[model samples]
Target chain A: MLILLWLKNKLAFIPYFRFMQVLLSHSKLKELISSLAKQLVEKHGSLNEVALVGIQQGGVAIADELVVAIRKQDPEAKFEYGQLDITFYRDDIRKNILTPDRMNLPFAVEDKTVILIDDVLFTGRTIKAALDVLLDYGRPGKVELCVLVDRKEHRQFPIQADFVGQAFETDRKDKIKLVNDEKGNKQVVLITG
Target chain B: MQLSTRHLLGIKDLTQEDISLILSTAEQFKEVLQRPVKKVPSLRDVTIVNLFYENSTRTRFSFELAEKRLSADTINFAASTSSAAKGETLLDTVRNILSMKVDMVVMRHSASGAPHFLSQHVPAAIINAGDGINEHPTQALLDAFSIKESTGGLEGKKIAIIGDIMHSRVAQSNVYLLNKMGAKVTVCGPPTLIPKYAAEAWGVEVNYNLKETLEWCDVANVLRIQLERQNQPLFSSLREYRISYGINRQLLDSLQKEIVIMHPGPINRGVELDSDVADSKQAIILQQVENGVAVRMAVLYLLSGRN
Candidate 1:
């Protein structure tokens, strides 16, 4: 299995397979997440007034990892955590059927510093929708975004993430996938036909 | 599921996915209804005209509240006060309203397919609030939404729509929407009230026995009898119909399993359903009304996208 993965990675370096390159290994992702948590703690001084909201599906796992890393740095930190599902807030709702994820925001978001977390930043439309949905909850004192991978192409909205793990440029046909193993191991891969 | 059609004329024009999309969108609007602000800026720039030609209290109020909650400017046009009462045709009245640069029209007319006719001629989006005995799309959408909220989903659920099936646009719309959502619909009423072609046309089970039908269902959606619409008595008497099919607390207590009860009001308390049963814990009648605003909000939001 190790030899097969190594061969796949080596083949991904070829120009033809460049679209299917694995950007970050599981350990590298963990290191970046830890660094992000440390940066957040230092920037905010404390997480008492901070609220970490995960955009559904892709952002959920990354949000959970960041929570654990933040806790490790400050065990007594009391950061509010919630999940936001922006399915209904999307502009393309009339064009297609979107199965909504569970929206479970248990606490109030009023007057809190909200940190929106997602897996990848692509066209920035999802972030726009998330911002619309979050306002319905309450007005936040400030809003910041954290993303795992930033695709520097085809952005239709004028929005950017405050903290990004890695940045890459890809063509329109290239697809970015964040894969997670059964043991919670994470990897980012770019796929193209 | 995207709503490909420009106007929501009936449930028959919608796909299963379209129904699902509407329900999910309504769920989000439901959340907004629970917020302290209870308003959104999604439709701030849009203008809606509630051109209700028929008399309505609940549906009109619900749609008006939904439009206001979405921050859309709305104009209420009743036929009693407008040119519709001056012998103006629906086309002319709607065209005049459209000329005012209306973004959408929520219409309730006395003639069937009135909205459909206006939809073809007018450029604005048309939402059928209720058109005679044809369809009330929003009512059915809210009924389906309430059922989904209670049971988590609509797939494989058994729903029995009782009373005034022939004169009810609600029954027709519910039958189509529920069946599309994979629910088994058994429409029950008196022999004279249940039209023969309903079963043959809609392919739904038609049963005259209410007790047996209720026993085999998960939800009982009781519709109000349109006494004003009936030119002649369809049944022998109101008392006779009530004795035969009226759902009371005694009948409900005898059921082996508890089932959710529903009624589209203004309910004839002693006629279709007893006040006790209507006020019972299993009844989701109030939820249906509350969901109406959210469902209408979703429909307006989606339709405004086309403009």
Candidate 2:
């Protein structure tokens, strides 16, 4: 395995099979995620057509870990993972970087249970933008939100996470960041105090 | 008490206190801009990137001046001139900048909500310079500031914004801000350009002709005709466009002469406006240009965690 070690800034996984491989080695999040996966499927009951859609960049790896853990119990379950870039749908359209990278909606998401996962949840607007886009394509039987960390702030939209690995109460001034560890495990950290 | 980086994406989310803060801060910066010094050390170590996907001279240069005055190192990045043509995406570019830990990003893109897109993915604070016909918050803010400066703060005044209502982001933004400042705004343009029920949506009166609009308005803001937007030729001809919709010198004669004339320009002389009217002292075209820098500086300073 050619270890592509970029301290940060690898987007879309365009050139390879594994993008966030650099993040898996640090924390024991993989083991913990394994235990949570068993509890989640057992509690929710069934994963036949359920799909995992990650909030791009940091959230994709965690979604992968969750999917792997789910497949362990029910191998026959259909699993589809996708990435969402909600820049265009945002209300604050002026502050975005003038030129975006390549804008791509590379998957067809129609009528599957979308388990939207993000590494850290803050204002919930990103989730809302993603949800708005998801609805534009097709209506799922049930659309659920899952996040590795829930930094509870006043949400502008009426949305909540279905599965939260951890929760933190923070003011508007604080920011929560999540990254993969050196041991191939994901870890969440607080950036601003 | 929060003094860290705060995003200034849209004015819709700002409180009256916030708007006052930005304008007052901008007012101070306006003095700094005029001084022989023409610079300040407030944002000395900061890195400001100008990401303009759309083509604009006035708005882009105003933001450029704002960054320069604050002593911030600025980089000009346009997609047409960058590796984007060779296939580099927008987020990939931001991630690269993120690695550099650049302080803030000011962006103007042709695609609506592009700024909002960057705010979500990137960690840095973002300012929307202008987005595709959605909103130009700073322009509206500065226009409001200029109006307030002239009429003792736009209270109980009739402001008319005339021409190209369908395409003018300036009209959409100013209508809202002026109303917020207690000014009765009248939007005048052709039936095709102005929406059929715009007055209902914007909570401002809409008129089809400029003559009637000018008689009632205290301030008349003229809008430029977008030549590039001529897909099927929006109007019959340039001569016809100027005659019917433009605030020409001939048309200006019949209106209340006290009404201040304004335009967010690259003024097509004799097209959307008469050459004499553009040069007229009543025209705040140049004032808007000059105030644009101060207004943007105020916006940047307001969001930059700098007082």
Candidate 3:
């Protein structure tokens, strides 16, 4: 009977495991991020005029990668970096209890072309909240959005990212997992029905 | 990690995570206070009522300043001139204030659990400033915030809360919060002033020896002896209490390593702490007072969230 139960569980997991596919591998992620950094520099004219503000948690890792890529291309390039925690500024704060991470902005955002970075762009609500919080710090010369995975159909707000690594269509119940391990292995996986 | 309750009635009602959240949020608000344009539009549309049944100068002003900094519309209600003096009940008075569409109530009452009682009856969010000898949570939060700033963190730090432990709401609040944040808390005072059950109840060490406690602690939070609250002499006399528990310059110099001195003021000059010690570089009483505004702002902002 125990063998039968184990076989039943294995049968159920097969289809779920089949649907899980890696969208980005470690090398591809590095190459794509480096290209994105080069593109940002090209658009902004120089890295000095550009400032990268990463949303807390996942976005910070993506921002770190972008900074490394930018420096790889131009070793003398200097870019303003910041990390913002938008937990307090969320519209659904009453429904959810969120403990915000530390918001560290060492440099001024004023009169700079601030490129807001995030890992996933789902409903665009997090970006909206980030925009609200960013204004409290200072007014920027221009604001742009960058995301690793843009769920194009899931946007609730009239928001769009200027630069995107990849875009995918998924069901409402589907989950996108950005797995960046401690060993510097990066992979994007889609778990869906 | 989020504060589950709408009302911050006491530190006893909060978890370790909840206290940490308040302190972290306060850290952000402290940065806002340093800016040229200090006001934030976080609570712009929210209205708060500062209802003080008991007389308070520091707590009341701090809450008011915090509310103003958040750009919230504030109304100050004192019991002396209010309808409470004209034989109005507490429930009726708050109901009247709520009828004007007040979103929150920051209250300080003489009776313990007074805010807790009103929290059940009213729909508005309640913040306990002080309710008798029960708790002064924001004061505890600000104290902890100041200590965290000075020491980098509260974990593994020794804090000795000195003076009238039995009657001090600040002492009770501090003991609960400091312990939760991984700080070793020792309640030091005269035996009469330090209740026997304090050690058993709160799991804090009770010490009568002031010099030993001072040497043991990294920070000594000296509480003012409440002469107004006490009905009879708990200690031998004021002079005896000062000699036994007082944090003076001589006592300050005796310590091998410099420790931070803290007082939740209106401090008695020579009672629990000496004047020189209160004004010294080691003292963070003023920093505690300044952090009070930021901590209250954080509390008000967190609680003001609604659907």
Report per-candidate DockQ: 0.22, 0.01, 0.27
In candidate 3, what are the lDDT values of residues A36-122, reduced to their tens digit?
Answer: 888887887557877899999888888999988888888888889989888766777656545567788777778988999998899
Candidate 2: CAPRI quality band: incorrect
Among residues 3 or more apart in sequence or in different chains, the pairs in candidate 1 whose N, CA or C atoms overlap within 3 Å are A96-B1, A97-B1
Could you give candidate 3's per-residue lDDT for residues B1-307 as a string of tens digits? 5577788999999988888889988988887787545776667778999999999999999999999998889999999999999999999999999999999999999999999999999999999999999999999999999999999999999999988898999999998998888999998988888878999999899888999999899999988888889999887888988877778899889889899999899999988888899999999989999999999988988788764
Better-scoring candidate (DockQ), 1 or 2: 1
Flag regions of model 3 displaced more than 4 Å.
A1-21, A151-158, A169-177, A181-184, A190-193, B35-45, B69-71, B234-244, B304-307
lDDT of 1: 0.88
Q: Which candidate, 2 or 3, has the higher lDDT?
A: 3
In model 1, where do residues sit more than 4 Å from their true spots?
A1-27, A42-46, A56-61, A71-77, A85-102, A119-135, A139-145, A149-193
| Cα lDDT, model 1, residue B243 | 97
Which is the better candidate, 1 or 3, if ranked by DockQ? Answer: 3
Q: What is the TM-score of chain B in candidate 1?
A: 0.98
